[model samples]
Target: MVVARTRTTCVLGALLGGALLVSGCGDDSSDDAFSGQKADDIAAKAVAATDKASSVHMKGTAKVKGASTVGLDIRVDDQGNCTGTISGDGARAQLLRSKGGDVLIKGDRAFWTNSARAGGGDAKQGEQLAGKLAGKWVTAPADGPDAAFCDKKRFLASMDQDKTERQGMKRGTETEVDGEDALTLEKEQEGNRISMHVATEGEPYILKAATAGSEDSTMTFDDYGEKVKVQPPSQDEIVDPADTQA
Candidate 1:
């Protein structure tokens, strides 16, 4: 499933990382609420509030520069527990990571077949591997590529460090996201226009973010502070990688 894992990583990275690219400043004045605030300050508040959240549910679609579009729905907690589904290029998989660091994944036939083929297996071999692996939860190391999907702490750390400085950020009209009051912050980098909606009611968390242009991506964040519920697969339902290798 290396191909699947890599696609997931790339999509998640772009979805999460590209959303926080607000910087510089704008002088445009909107009569709407939040007109008194600077775009950079508002963006900073959203970042800080999101960073303090103990857990969150993220759902989004991202298309990296040269990759196919990927869709993900995941809930993750600071304690490292996560449960999610990822889909791309006609393949899909369900993933779970426990607080104790064990990772498990169950992929559909297309996911396994694509993985096998990506790993250099012939068409027949790919079909055979897919038959054995499809619909079965398989163990992956805590530090493996799949783990990247489950690593909330790591994701946050990367976010903290990816603060890029760019220009042309502006504040837009106030709006509601999922019924919560929000203010929009927008900026254009290179040829892509990025827009973000920061909650105005409570913690100022980013409620939605989107980029349009060279690489299209959109992500929404919600269920802040909710606990991540991750249940490990029963022994009978798990397919050990060692056995598969053997």
Candidate 2:
């Protein structure tokens, strides 16, 4: 059996470290598209469209000072299944879902290193650990400890969030996300400034969203209803913490 995973630097632990990576991105290839409408109005339509589709391919990054900075690249299904990697600090973890609707997370040795750091382990231990479990998989059931934060339904719903109720939300900038034209809905509410981008051409799907100032966070949404297949880690390579912990 493997040495016990320190609750301090667990792969599942990072779930506690950051926010959602917004879903969906990209626009229709057609030339004629929605324009000249309010940012919130366009965003509302995009959210409605996404809600109607119910899934997307999402990617983004978020950083909070003195905390882990996470980068997420994942594909989410309408039913709330995510298959992707959340990488940051000294670790990388992959979240996968089975067709039977089970979601599981697996992390690399670096994940343990980071978990150790979070748990207060020193750097040398992490280095020694790297050689011990590199490329090995430490698995966690999504419903298990520290895994509730990765609920797929909650992650999907976050993309449709529109802050039209904010006191002073308005159009901010016209930018290009990977060459696709985008419109940003800008706002400042109670000292927090937010900018959300939507495609100006196709379906108005969210292109990205960001908050300015300290504790920076950004999420970009696109690829509604694309085919996503997530397979589980092989049993031979899987190690459950519960087994050894017991």
Candidate 3:
């Protein structure tokens, strides 16, 4: 069963910053131009790249701390929904991808809603693991075509309006993410500093998000030219729909 084998063998179609400020006042126009490109523009590129990876099929492996600890094979469709199965220890559970932006896990019998209210309902062992995978969706670039970057766009827009460099600047470094070379973006703003490793893997862009302040999140994309696939989930093992919430 895929669910029982928890030593990290959940194979098959599986998945998948910073800054500070000080002193009184300052403004280096050159520095601002170099680094402070409108968050909208930069985010647009990211979102555009992401929007291109929609309605595609992909297979990979994933792992999350304090979570289910299994490998997965997941899939997503053009409508922005996902589904799949996870395997570990010969135990397998069905994973459902919802159009409403949440996941329902079978076998362990748990469901998670994409509520921004901080805490949802009961967290299952599998759900906890899935949380590590699903939670990253919230970080999608705002100002994109889908309005998916709702939270991020709002935050950056707020900063832009205040003219407050709450997020600090970065002298980025060239680094590798998910085996692809990318420019690691770093920033410290509004009491939150985060470093995001951006890269491309075929159609879906990969955004590995990590914060100096809290938990880390990862998002994979599958670009279909017009629409993009964001935060895709499992593909292979299909948990019984009846076992999940409707």
The estimated TM-scores of all candidates read 0.82, 0.69, 0.38
Ranking according to lDDT, highest score first: 1, 2, 3
Alpha carbon deviation, residue 85, candidate 3 (Å): 6.2
**Candidate that beats the other on lDDT, 2 or 3, i.e. the better one:** 2
Whole-model lDDT values for every prediction: 0.69, 0.58, 0.35
What local lDDT score does residue 74 receive in model 3, on the 0 to 100 scale? Answer: 50
lDDT of 3 by residue, 1-54 (tens): 001111211111121111111101122232322255433334334434543444
What lDDT, from 0 to 1, does candidate 1 have?
0.69
C-alpha RMSD of each candidate structure in angstroms: 4.8, 7.7, 12.6
1 or 2, greater by TM-score: 1
Residue-pair clashes per prediction, in order, are: 0, 11, 58
- Tens digits of per-residue lDDT for model 1 on 51-70? 78999888888765455777
Return the top candidate by lDDT: 1
lDDT of 2 at 151: 48
